[model samples]
Target: MVLEDPSNPLVLRNYAQYLESKRDFSGAEEFYFRATQADPNDGEILSRYAKLVWELHGDQTRASGYFERAAKAAPEDSNVLAAYANFLWEIDANEEEEHSSNAQVDENAVLVDLPAKDFKEEKRPSSPPLHLAMGLGIGRMDLVGINQDYIISCPDDRTTLEEYYKRVVDENPCNPLFLRNYAHFLHQSKGDLHGAEEYYSRAILADPSDGQALSLYADIVWQRHHDKDRAVVYFERAAQATPETVFIPFGFSNVLASYAKFLWEVEDEEDAIEEAKNRMPVGQGTATAANA
Candidate 1:
């Protein structure tokens, strides 16, 4: 029987989002599946559910399906277009590494992203291709403004990342994302803590929900200015706004543990213990969390 209520889909979507935020992947997937079943024809539902499956289980086929559905649903959404393209690139890299045992393109090739125009109906492959330089292009472009968590951060890639981020910022100064992430890159890679602080301040002004930026900025201020009280405020804010990614709780716990150690070393055993206790019973996930 067809359900007549549109709110049904909305409730399922929100519940799924909550579970995902809580890092309950299986539970989230279950609800997403329910959402998909309840609204099979909904492009958003298909796309979202497909995304959840891939995100939770690393199921490429399923992920691709949903991403495709999402793209189809929102043909004009650059975000969806870019995400799907990047996924294609990942698929290619996996296959290449699996077969060739090495991907040292050295001078033989420069990465090239095949724009969507290249994927005409007659030329579609039996499966997704093993290369889509376009995906890296998409990542380079789309991720430039995004504030990735500390865990996924690859500081060594700062130069190229910075170039892209600068380009993005130049194109859209109002987009505080690139500026904020650039600040993180500076702090982490170049030790330009002051520069990072300025950028972070700007980002916070631009968007209150930029918790990663705010939290990291707080860490910098606390460590740089030796303001533990202020740092704790940021940490608490981050923990509050933080999503249930694979790394957030772990990141929070690690920082807390480090703060505790620092306090203990300084003979502030009370605060040290307090900090340690704060992160204890770490939410869930990761090897460290399991040990805790």
Candidate 2:
């Protein structure tokens, strides 16, 4: 069918899904790419391609580009918005884990020190890496590792990462993924709570159903702004927006847990607390209460 009607994006996408189920990832990738080229506005195809890239190849940066495109192509698609939000959460979790691991390095561990004469200074490259060029060609300035490479290549330059993030947000202003990431970078790395809050608000404005952004924004409101009422509103919205599915069980569970905790501890709203508890999975309510 695909060969007979080579321009049929649905057929191409179906074939890609079939190939993916058969574990023919390379062939599936080809078909998926073809499907996207055939119908660039198909958010479903773009989301599927993004998931395949992330799951099969573990290429977060490339998957992010596809997901961003998917969200842009279909701003009103709930499934696509949920998937993109989940991807951003996964990226945040991985980055936090990496930071935690780095922080755990033994302070007392002895390091072998080489003589000064044993080391030679290496010349820095005149331009960004090849991956950066490819990313630029594809209008993906937010490829994670390429931007990190540019920053690492010039350790003395602290603004490289911020500049790239600014450019990405500028180019994709309404993209929740970019806005959320920029907000996170500002809050965590730059210590700019005001900027983070602004971007987080923009992200939520772009996609009010983005549970991750809603949850994180709630945290900022609670911790930084000390606006308990507003924070509760955001947390409740996050809980309502987050769907309980195998793909995003953690996100849903976390939102529910946080909401419950806030209701119980912060607002001391017993009725609301019980409501939130009932929404949680069995045993999660007990654990959340204990943690609270």
Candidate 3:
């Protein structure tokens, strides 16, 4: 039914996802290829296809090509950039492993003397290879911008990751995911407490019922600003927004834990311990409720 409109990229992409979920690699690849052909400029779709290719083929070289294409397609899209960064990180890790394995093999091999080959002057190309000199026709996005998190973590590049976060935030001001992640990046990487707080405020304002955002905001305000009163307000809000039963450990319970810690450690309230016990008891009821 979805493929009825073969021209619709969204439908094609969704079909591709369905195929991928079903573990139909070839089917998924065909659908993804069609989707990309239908909308070559869609960064999200490209990224999805890139990830599928990587998972299906387990070849970082081919996957990197797709990732580079996706990043170029959406230079300002933070998700695509992050995906590209992850791809690069994996490739680097794989290369390091290969080098380590080679070194170990070399170390175990017994030394043997061999006659040195005579040096010969071979015919060389008159000019550099055309492909080597040629640039990808697509606009060149700054490597630092696409791999901001990697750069910040490694700290090898001279450029700061602040600009990339600022650009992504500016481009996607209303996106809660982007705003919260940018806030986190600023807080962790740059130690820009004030800037992080501002972005966090925007994220919370956009979605009051977001327990994670509320908890994160509370943590930041309490830790950095040292305003326990303001922090507790957000924490209480987070607890209220939390569901009674959550399957995910990092769900509502994590937020509650944060709140409990603040109460016990900072406020020194005995109710904190009581609240934890009351909220989550060690019994089949918790498991049953989670299953339900």
Clashing residue pair totals per candidate (backbone < 3 A) = 3, 0, 0
Candidate 3 lDDT score relative to the true structure: 0.66
How does each model score on lDDT?
Answer: 0.58, 0.73, 0.66
lDDT of 2: 0.73
Candidate 3: minimum summed lDDT over ten consecutive residues — where? Answer: 129-138
User: Which candidate achieves the best TM-score against the true structure?
Assistant: 2
Better of 2 and 3 by lDDT: 2
Model 1, range 1-292, lDDT digits (tens) per residue?
1145544867787788898899988888888778877666666667667776766688987787787666556543434444554555556556756767665555433335544455333242222111111122222232322232211123343434446555555665655566666676677666888988987887777777656666777777776887767766775565455442223222433433333333343346556767876777755335565698
Model 2 misses residue 84 by how many Å?
1.2
TM-score for each predicted model, relative to the true structure: 0.35, 0.40, 0.38
Model 3 misplaced stretches (Cα beyond 4 Å):
105-292
Write candidate 2's Cα lDDT for 118-183 as tens digits: 432222324433322222222233443333424445657544666767776888799887788778
Best-first order by lDDT: 2, 3, 1
Better of 1 and 3 by lDDT: 3
Where model 2 places Cα greater than 4 Å from the true spot, the runs are 107-292
lDDT of 2 at 194: 92
